[model samples]
Target: MPAFPNSCFQISVLLLGLAAGPGLLGCARVVSATTSAAAADCLVYVGTNVASEQENTIYLYRLQAATGTLTRLDAQPGGAAPTYLTMDAARRHLYAVSETQTFRGAASGGVSAFAVDKKTGHLTLLNQQPSGGGAPCYISLDRSEKNVLVANYVGGNVSLLPVQADGRLAPAASVHQHEGRGPHPNQTSPHAHCILPDPSNQFAFAVDLGTDNVYGYRLNAKEHQLAPAAAPAFTAAPGAGPRHLTFHPDGRYAYLINELNSTITALQYQDRQYEKGPAAFTELQTVSMLPAGFTGPNSCADVHVSPDGRFVYGSNRGHNSLAVFAINPGDGRLTLVQHVSTQGQTPRNFALDPSGQLLLVANQNSNNIFTYRVDQGTGKLTPTGHSVEVPSPMFLQVVSDFTR
Candidate 1:
């Protein structure tokens, strides 16, 4: 009998959930966080997606901050393709987008709300409301937590949904449509990928991948509405599909990940109240998220700044790595720090724990999640040598209990 090729062997091991050597393939197992004397308890919520309409569930796990171990806690029935999730500031509620084109007989997706059970880390379905668009891909809470903003990838629009007092979602109070296109083949129409408020909470920005535009809006928290800003849009380079945006904690800088071009653009933000609007943004520098000379198909997914605002991290899908960069304190420029393997395939999303000591990555295609220990002085990630197996884990949200 002929021996299997190395690539085939690795694929077979991954599919069979067999143990494999380090740096080659991840082993499958049901592991949880164990308690240690110095452990801080953290609740991790993972959203999953599958190819079909088969009901997928959102999983809850208990994370031991000291050990970086994850133990399964509970599972809630998340509707079809709950691909993205966001938690409120109080950690009392969780919101996720059911990424489907049809919802309750309407040609729109849905956003579901869940009440977080503090004791058991369980989630109870609060309610779900029509997201006012089709294929809602991203969801986020405004700075004031009074409204939820959703980006519709297929509908080419963004919507603001009012949050009820009981942590439920109301119908969209305002919907804004994006119009334009980019040079990429995927940019045949507008695709609003993500929307969130700036650090000042006075202006919200929507990154549209299909249009290569970052649109700004005046956030009216009182009325739970969004209006176009004076500086309505900042256009990125043509064919550079901006997927997500993250602001520096200092509120002086913003980072955008371009999915089509595999690059990150750093911009300086001004929050001075002008007569027309309250914010302005100017591009500082654009940097590549991949190493030189290794040309492979890659798409950038998520971009996030460390809690201390000293580092920036972005996810690479085809490259299956996390690119880390150090922020220059003087000018808010980025210096490449490291590119570490995500230990699995297609790391579509990741999150940094509140303490900033741990980073969790969701390997969407490999059906697993991995943890890394972060170095504070240098923005480097060291694998914790720990992983947990879940089916099609697409997003991760960590709610930390630092008091523990």
Candidate 2:
């Protein structure tokens, strides 16, 4: 933990004053005290793609927790086209996928590891390994933090990489090639979009957009391997192109956002196993992410459940809005709440701060990040009018000091 200078403290106080009113007197006090604490160094990391004009890099920013303001800290060269990033549970290591078709002369993507400097929030490259597939787009850590799982979009496969004690990635332990296609043109071949471990840590779900199915894999922590689950896969609509999946905090329900159709499906999740069969998930309902009669072209990119599990949100690319939904506590169903504009175009990725009080959206086409304040009670979002310009910002992640 470090102390801020007098000038930094004054600036923080002034910004907090402008963001909150007298009605938030009690909250303001807590925020001020927390921001002043030596351990209040929150960090934000943004991953950008390498285009003709853009460099493959990961930019670091220091977050003013009290005001949702981000101050540039540093930038490091991420390997070729870093599309997605993930941090280890200890917050000491960062992992990113270099979405390339060739790695070390092989037809595969690459994953790089970086060591996080807690004091300055700087990242230092550690090592790199083959992603076991081509065009790896997503990476995530297992609940045990013993392995890193990656999804390859172009190769349509999922791979697991063992994590070493020093935070470097070992060669992939296993790679599972996906099979099948969907009705959409983009589904000519398999396209694994996201890999997320279940809350129970017993299973991992890989969403394959091209297959129109979510494949489940049983995690073997001891062996550091992944095997097809007893209940292998859950099928979506013909051309749904399910891209992302999220689970309720209670672990009783899950939601999937379909990119091709711009719809979300709710499912009842049960972890119980019977002598006759394995655990299963039952589809509960499906709802459109767009407004009625607004039949323009749109695609969904992200989905997340609120910290409280009382609400869920889906990001629409063409609509340039966030679709909010209220969660039914009784049956895990969802009801449309509101659609709030993101104030930018092509919001490729967004993240909620550690406190769940603020949301930041990275608009790729607009090249700006928009901030929004969350209404905890009603599950609505209001723009905070706090935005920062960046280049080709595709992924945003928040790492809290406390977690570190």
Candidate 3:
């Protein structure tokens, strides 16, 4: 392995209907990470919508890791427009962003905590809190599983909340409102699209789509808090609209995918800062999502670094394609490898299985989930020739061995 961030499960029979809204409830505790469950024996958890409407429910599915087969477990109704999702380290809880205009008695979007049943794939609502702003499109939990961080896109804010002992959630412990504008009229506003922590969990990075900036934060895991880093935010080109970012497993370099421009940036990491070394980078070699001369409009959504540290994948909306790239391990650079058809419309998000042998692409516009077989040795994706039809598939994540 060269260098990248070191980072660190599903179920579903019970459909816990929230009286007021969804609440988290508990089931199993992960007693051991050494369960001897093969990558092909893992469980998959997915977050989608209700009939492609505004948002009303999240469905749980069982994925046959070896075959890439999916079976719906049960559906739970809560929060509005759950555009994104993240799982706790222990696979005992789940977090989702409620991308609505209002939430938790506040005029902003919010987040929800749910208990996980590794065996049944069902989730019980634990708690809900305002994410400190509107349209909470993205959320994540620290590796310690002690804090939940949320990013409000339209509201232009980021907030942190405490996770309870039982996998429930507390109110906002800290909230930061971002300021500034980008170049384009549509992209020149503050829109915090994602909140993610580096693989080491030493720092956090938040990507803003509207302002063309990637904000970095210093984390206090023991204290359960977060603050802006000394070098606060990194600026991208005007109107780039950065959406999602990822780091190589070795932690030597990082990558960011710009939503507006449909470009990929390779960055070298040295001393916790992007340095001017062989790995140091500031601009993209090229944008890889579109077909030649077939542009209507383009927006990139998600970015992921392959487990083996040899490839990266990003999603394009209007272009409706998955851009693939090969990484030069010697110098943290990217070369456009291939562009694959998502076989559906508006692929809002995708996730790789823990074993890194499978990929799931959520097509939000066409209401379906597409699966692909991943070739670890060569960093390539081949269609599995199968799909699961669902309503407004927005976000996808894996819950390994949800059954303890």
At residue 51, what lDDT does model 3 achieve?
39
Q: How well is each residue in 1-404 modelled by candidate 3, as lDDT tens digits?
A: 12223222011101111111113322222221223323543455566656356547787776666667777777777567776788765567888888887775679987888887756768888888788889888777776778888888888888888888998888888787888888877775799988876655666678888787777666666687777643434677788888877767787777888888778788765533332112223443445556567668878888887666788888888878888888888888787777888999988888776656678899988889988877666666788777898888787766554443
User: RMSD in angstroms, all models?
Assistant: 12.4, 9.9, 7.9
TM-score per model over all chains: 0.88, 0.88, 0.85
Candidate 3, which segments miss by more than 4 Å at Cα?
A: 1-38, 50-55, 230-232, 272-286
Each prediction's whole-model lDDT (CA) = 0.80, 0.78, 0.71
lDDT of 1 by residue, 219-280 (tens): 77779988875444467899999999888877778888999999999988755532234335
Query: Candidate 1: where is the Cα deviation over 4 Å?
Result: 1-39, 273-279, 402-404
Score residue 62 of candidate 2 by CA lDDT.
65
Query: If both were scored by TM-score, which would come out higher, candidate 2 or candidate 3?
Result: 2
Question: By TM-score, how accurate is candidate 2?
Answer: 0.88
Considering summed lDDT, which 10 consecutive residues are worst modelled in model 2?
8-17
Q: Which window of ten consecutive residues has the lowest lDDT sum in model 3? A: 9-18
Alpha carbon lDDT of residue 84, candidate 1?
A: 89
